[model samples]
Target: MSQERRNFDKEFKLMTVELSKSRESIQELAKELGIRAELIYRWRPEYLEKPEGSFTGHGKPRHTPEEAEIARLKKQLRDVEMERDILKKGHQHLLQGRREIYRFIACQSSRFPVDKMCEVLKVSRSGYYSSLKGTVSKRAKENQELLSLIKQEHKKSRQRYGSPRISQALRANQVQVSRPRVARLMKQAQIKARMVKRFRVSTDSK
Candidate 1:
């Protein structure tokens, strides 16, 4: 195997071991690996899925008739595992070839007309153009800043600001926005206004 494959295997194994607890996120992992998170996402050249079986109990002897049957079962299991390993290696080879093809197409596209890449890669022209769009537009970023300000106003009022109240607050701050649009964005963001729950109200007393 190449050094790249070796690195991929090590990284994959490390990720798999902590998959259940991978709250650290791939963005964090990319920072550690000194690459973009998108690169990290595209790193699984061979197998993107979790691999199976372990190399434990290789020399341990079977203890009873049941254990002996277990040993036999283990032997069959190893044979099946060997077959799977062969398949994985084949898939890895195919993935490497595909990566090479994509890179060649990208480089060629940079030089020549992109119609060639569209024909070769079999992707739509509109779809390709759409992919070039930046993550967050300036207007969207400005709207987000306004949202932060709106949240601050809502916070000051102890989150009692529903769409109407938030609209009023925004207008008061010279925002000049509509309540319905604010409602839509807030709903899309899942930022519901605070209300006195029975649990909280019942528990509170003088």
Candidate 2:
């Protein structure tokens, strides 16, 4: 009885070629992968020369020029659509702070690729990954505590107090905080003081 010949897919061939570049011994890699060393040696040059067109199995038809052009256009369309979706969902965050942008990316990470989101949002990939670790600095913790207090005081005043009044009110309670910092936090939290209309005892002349 004759033994059937083994067949390798394009992915496997490409992976083998990539492994061959980093590996010290092609023979060792081939032995581990259960293939002949000559296969890696043959795949390397072909992959290096035309990576996209390489290792299209023996019977498979090669892509025509029109097909290749269509493939390229389809890729471009997909990329454009991805960017449009990202922007449509995350446009508001773009106008806000970097932390807000990071939060948006983290929230939308399930829908889109993190690296692509980072690229589209103009934020560093390392920063986005670091945000994933959920590390809050001492100052940030302090600010959060201060913001809580500010919210309480603002509500107590019935939204009639701005940052300066809030700062004075905080100090009266023995909480040492700056007005500018209060203003910034208020801006971030969208806390605004309501304007009071004063009554004037004046009659209109007819």
Candidate 3:
């Protein structure tokens, strides 16, 4: 005995097409819907091109010439997007580069893909993972030290010292660092100088 194929209604097809507009991947939606991924892809353009006229019955799509062109362009756009995603994953492979740069890129991996950074930075995905597991870079370590000193000095002065004064103070202790560098670190650490207000005297005579 052979089981017959299940047929979905027009509304179901239209709803499936709508769901594909989300960030969810087509494979994920197909798995959730218990249907093949290709079916969703196939139905999307047809339904999008002619929402009311599509899936009226049988596999026929009623589309005008303009609608047909629009559907073709949409398909082309999807193809281009796919290509761009692929390129982004493997941009320029640079082998002997700074680890700090990779770390910065890795920090943004939640917004951007790690594979993209790995490709662009010329680091292997495995190398990128290993770098993440490793200790902080020397420059970052120094920045932390400077930031701590900056905080201490900032508080000692009642937060009245901006980068220029802070640089002189650091030099007094033989720190020998640049004011601009101190300023950049302070910015990153969210350290702001406290603004002092001048005292004003008011007198009233009657």
* Backbone clash count, each prediction separately: 0, 0, 2
Clashing pairs for predicted structure model 2, backbone only:
none
Q: What would the per-residue lDDT of candidate 1 be over residues 77-143, giving only the tens digit for each residue?
A: 9766654544443333335543343444455564545664554445556655544563454666777
lDDT sort, best first:
2, 3, 1
TM-score of each: 0.33, 0.48, 0.45
Per-residue lDDT tens digits of candidate 3, residues 1-206?
99778788888888888889993689999999999899998999887777778987665777779989999999999766754654464343233245655655665677666765555455678766766788566787898899999999999999999999999999999998999999999987889999999999999998
C-alpha positional error of residue 80 in candidate 3 after TM-score superposition, expressed in Å: 9.5
Give the candidates in order of TM-score, highest first.
2, 3, 1
Question: Model 2 compared with the native: what TM-score?
Answer: 0.48
Segments of candidate 3 deviating more than 4 angstroms: 1-83, 86-117, 121-127, 202-206
- Assess candidate 2 and give its lDDT: 0.89
* TM-score computed on alpha carbons, candidate 1: 0.33
Candidate maximizing lDDT: 2
lDDT of each: 0.59, 0.89, 0.79
